[model samples]
Target: MTHIYNDPRGFKEDMIEGFVRAHRDRVRRVPNASAVMSSRAPVKGKVALIIGGGSGHYPAFCGLVGEGLADAAVIGDIFTSPSAEQVYRCTKAVEGGAGVVYSFGNYSGDVMHFGLAEMRCESEGIDVRTVLVTDDVASAPPEQREDRRGIAGDLYVFKVAGASAHRGDPLDEVERLARKANDHTRTVGVAFGGCTLPGKSEPLFRVDPGRMEFGLGIHGEPGVSTSELLPAPELARLLVGKLLEEAPPDADGTVALMLNGLGSTKYEELFVLYRYVSELVERAGLRIHHPLVGEYVTSLDMAGCSLTFLWLDEELRELHDAPARTPAMIWEVKR
Candidate 1:
């Protein structure tokens, strides 16, 4: 797309080098591998969580690998799954005696590759488990929840897993808690425009100018349907309504609301969306225990946003508030 790139084949390496250069103090390239593990590794007997997927979704796999998110992240090319060898290497590199847990979105290629990596780790005597984040309601019917695709809900999984590890939770318990977070989270997104692949001249999908696609996937996969662009409040209401319908908050429940910027969406716009979402959620008789607003997860340069809600309990609240220092996520210890 009139962008800078020698060839499509070199895109991954180009991006990786740039990323390492930019985050040298916090992230380091995994030795003899195509992944980047956090510099703050070997977390003192804590369970290590490894996550990976195709590239182009910056801040999704690698950007989140820091003090409070993933311990290791393996990346493949744009919209492609990392090889089993890469996954195995990352898992081995980050594994502590407590073991390694792989958390990824539910995609056929990811499942196969990561599954193979898991088996390879088991053969090598590394205790490994996996939790797939499948919270996209637009992918399947309510009765077929397992078939749902994973979207922004992965942020919640990383938060729980990292907090568990930070608290010295054993491998098994970390896996359990991560699974719990995955089960209680849901995400739905919309796109005002599709994204362009590196070196490509045009976007993957086209939305009529001034229109938006509701329930859109990060990769420009078809959304539920198209509609005219509505005002920020109305749009928030419609999107949040879908999430509530799928996973309604408890009468007195507390939750963490994540307002994710797809890619090019401005912070001011996201805050506007959050303002309305918080109001609607509170009006529904539910408490928003914490609110995470920013570009925690993103597609390429797509212009849109996604909403993720995590129904929280006491334990989750503590975990959510725990101190975490990372390139993207930093918190001060609360006395």
Candidate 2:
């Protein structure tokens, strides 16, 4: 039972229309497409960063548009990839003459469509490079890690990519840093309930009362494990333990920790969980840097959350703490 809009097919268009209006001060729609670029996009002489993904994740591909973030974002239907034509149109708006780097979660449809856009750019002489994010540790085994799905860890990929471009790094360097961000990040999540897309009377999946699904997808896809919902502290220990087992960082190293709500979880609940999450990180002998707790990425109305750790080396730490001015995020350089 979704209570959001008029028509299902027209839902995405309407949402985008309203989004640009509300954020007009910061973003503008690309002519003839659903892409939205920063009001100050095309920062000539600097590399442009264009990010895209399916709709439904607010403050993601759209809200992330602004200075020091993505230059433009291509919009697709709810959980659906945008067409090559739509992505192609984005190049015209965000191309800053240096080049454009298209980065996004490593989903099948996104790969196909964005790949098409990559070829399109080559034909038109617009230098566009693609960097796919694969950071969801639960989606694949370490040996096949490259095949994993990209989840909330995408924020680090976009942030580092955007920061690199903002600093006028060459396209090659930007792509390298974007991939490095992906390599340095890992995420694992759980879902307590499922989400219902617009015009649907039922959720995509279901969980019994007092039970939960582990490693669930953002689109309501089931996870690798399921069990009764545990208390906040226990849940925190479980999540941190799983992530560390997957890829343990240096005991004395620092990491950027993010506790993200999957759309329906409350900030209060997340804070309670963060208390224990913080303790575990310190006990693990790792210092948490710029630990963020909020709804940065989400599933439609799924009552769940995910934990992400971007293992920070010197360069990653510097770029991550750098200033970023976007519709949904802004930070002054701490220098």
Candidate 3:
């Protein structure tokens, strides 16, 4: 299904080169490293926010590098973790003398690799901290929240960290706010089809014609369960209801929500789904702030979608509304 590539081994490299060429005004390739940094990075006294993960999820680990977002994003092979050396090189290139905060999904490989980089950076007197995103509710039960996988919810966690750091917050404060954002976020997804890796002939997995895989992962892993596909309204209820059940203890009815498409889903279809989602939220007496309906985090070409909710308090709301300009997302105040 993956049709465009000269060689499988060089896919990531080629993609990076093209990305840097296209976004040169806002970002630049990290010298001798598989990473990209904001053009205005190393902001003298600002805490640097570094976010990354495997390739294939566009607008995520790379497209997010810009003003009011991540200072840098390290890239890796498809569905693979970036090397520790790559992370260290990116840190050295972007740290502005304040500190560094590394944030990414909570996967075994990511945790191990990023941890190694963190230790190395700290040894050289760089105050580097990390915040793992664990927001996929279907990956773990409430009693084992720490074991959940990170999915589309990466957006909220990264946004909070970037905004906090952009405002010149100390490393401690940035880390705290990032963690708080992760704690308040939850996501659940389903897959109607699977994605094929570059240079591969077959998809990673397949879904039945009339059924959907619930709680699917972003890395082509199958879902936890499967059921017959329902109409858009029913699907919306299924998603919104699941999130409301796991609302944080202190949730006060206000939330930031995102309905993210995996890939191959039509934009018009997403709007139809949101019509029902918005109604469901109001019916549950929750106020939706800044509802986003589009692909944010994706599993390359997978036909599916996920819904995320960030239970917001005063602080989270302010940061969520902060001005940001990136390749995939842009928010600015109206004059």
Candidate 4:
């Protein structure tokens, strides 16, 4: 299918220009790149949290940049990794004396490029740590869990890491908290229909009428299975069942649930799915601290959703509830 923006190479540049122009006060365009450092820089003693990836994942990499999320987000073309230089510049732009924490989904290209950027920061006397998020259960078996791809769970890590930084946690502690969040989280997604790239007139993948792709990735990748579309309640049961089996919620455990729309899904549909997910969790005798239902992360205009559950202890719960003011997320401070 032909896309409107046939020039994929210019995708990042075009997006950055438009994004900064529309949200000038909230975002500052990093010079000569698709990176944008948050206008509300963390205090000098607070650690900085940086996340970046290709541009198609809207709020995932860029929209999450604000007071409560990432301090800086580097952008790349559609489903492409940002250059090491882009990552380095963003790191330099947002780093405070305390240090910087780099968090992103577990993609080989992202890991290699961001890894190089970390080394660059180290060489320049800037402290930095990396946390790779591998929360997608469909990508790997339990024994090879670390090989799983990172998906919406990255948002949970960002929330935890951002709150840690806000509390003036040391760089090491911040990184530790982010890693802990990653370890405690798991996600699974299903797509009703694939998204068409910006310029493309056709979608990358097509779902048979009334069918859904289960365990699909954000980039229109193949799923574990495709089956007839189920009602919201039944679909929720399937998704929640998979997550619970993988990481069962403790009877008294406080959990943070994210019912994220890939892009094209409507809010009403998400709430419907949330309704069932909430019921299932409560049925399992688990407490959901904050049930987030929206498009916290996305995959272009894909018509699907993902569910992420983060089992939280006292410390993680407090951190997760901490006030954050980002374009995409805002909440009360947890005192």
Ranking by TM-score: 3, 2, 1, 4
Alpha carbon lDDT of residue 14, candidate 4?
A: 71
Question: What TM-score fits each model?
Answer: 0.94, 0.97, 0.98, 0.94
lDDT of 2 by residue, 1-335 (tens): 46989999999899999999988999999999989999998788999999989988887889999888899999999888999999999888779789889999989999999999889898889888888888888898888888999889989999999999998899999999998888888999999988899989899988899998889887678888899899998999989998888654442388899999988899999999999999998998888898889988888888999999998888888889888888787866444
Q: Write the per-residue lDDT of candidate 3 for residues 109-182, one digit (tens) a residue.
A: 98998899999999999999999999998999989988999999999999999999998899999999999999
lDDT of 1 by residue, 1-335 (tens): 32677777888888888888989888999998889989988676888989989887767888878887788889988888999999988887888778988998899889999999999999989899999998887788887878888889988888888888878888888898988888788888898988888778789888898899988887768578999988999998997898888664442377788899988898999998999999999887878866878887777888889898888887776777777666666755353
Question: Which stretches of model 4 miss by more than 4 angstroms?
Answer: 1-9, 248-252, 333-335
On the 0 to 100 scale, the lDDT of residue 212 in model 1 is 90
Model 4 Cα lDDT, one tens digit per residue, 122-222: 99999889999989988888778789999999999988998898888898899999998998899999999888876667898999999998898987785
What are the lDDT figures for the candidates, one per model?
Answer: 0.84, 0.88, 0.93, 0.85
Q: Clash pairs of candidate 4?
A: 2-200, 2-201, 3-199, 3-200, 3-201, 4-199, 5-199, 323-333
* TM-score, prediction 4: 0.94
Which is better, 1 or 4, measured by lDDT?
4
Root-mean-square deviation (CA) per prediction: 1.9, 1.4, 1.1, 2.1
